[model samples]
Target: MENVVPFKIQIISILATLGFMYFIVRQIIRGKLREEYSIVWFACTIVLLIFSFWRKGLEQISLALGVFYPPSLLFLLAIGAIVTFLVHLSIVNSKLQSQIKDLAHEVAFLKEKQLNESTIK
Candidate 1:
C-alpha cells in the first residue's frame, strides 16, 4: 500500500517473516517440506523482509519495472509464483501416478507367475 505503515506494523511484519522462515526450516528438517519446494517460500519471505525494512523499495522496483502501480506489481509477482508452484506440484503428482500404475502392474504379474508355478508343482 502507498499509505504509510506504522512503525509498529513494520516491526510486526519483520517479526512475522522471521517466524515464517523458522517454520519453513523446521518443516524441512522434519522432512515435511523438501528444500526445492521451500525455495519459493523463502524467496517470497526475503522479498517481504526487504520491503518491510525499506518502505520505498516497492516504489523503486515498480518504477524500474515500468509498473504504474506498485501494489499491482506485487500482486502479479505473487500470482506468477503461485501458478509456477502449482504447475510444479502437478508435474510431480503426474509422475507419482505413473509410477504407482507401473508398480501395480508389476505386482499383478508377479502374483500371476507365482500362482502358475504353484499350480504346476
Candidate 2:
C-alpha cells in the first residue's frame, strides 16, 4: 500500500507539471505573458518535471539539503523562485522609474525653453 501511494503521487506530479507547462506555453503563444516571464515559468516547470520523473534524485537532494521531509524541499524551491522573481521585477521597476523621471525632466525643460522664446518674441 505504501509503495502504491508513492507511485500514485509520482503520476499526479507528472500530470500537474505537464499541465503547468501547457498553461505557460498557451499564455506565451496568446501574448498574455511576455517571453521573459514565460522563460522563468518554463524553467520552473521543467525542473518540477525532472524531479517528478526522478524520485530518487529528489530524495537525494532533500537529504543533501538536510531536509528530513522531501516535500519541504519543494516549498523551499518555490519560495526561492518567488524571491528571485520579485527581485527581477524590482530591477525592472527601478529602470522604468529612472526613465520616466528623465523623460519628465526633458519635457519640463522643453516647455520652459518654448515659453522663454514666446516671451522674448
Please name the candidate that would achieve the greatest TM-score relative to the true structure.
1
Give a tens-digit lDDT track for model 1, residues 13-70. 9999999999999999999998998998999899889989998777888889999888
Instruction: Work out the TM-score per prediction.
Output: 0.85, 0.74
lDDT of each: 0.91, 0.86
Q: lDDT of candidate 1 vs native?
A: 0.91
Cα deviation at 61, candidate 2, in Å, is: 1.9
What tens-digit string does per-residue lDDT give for candidate 2 at 1-121?
1231288889998999999899988988899999987888889998988888877886777779898887788888899999999999999999999999999999999999999999999
In model 2, state the lDDT of residue 83.
99
Off by over 4 Å in 2: 1-5, 107-121
Tell me model 2's lDDT, rounded to 2 decimals.
0.86
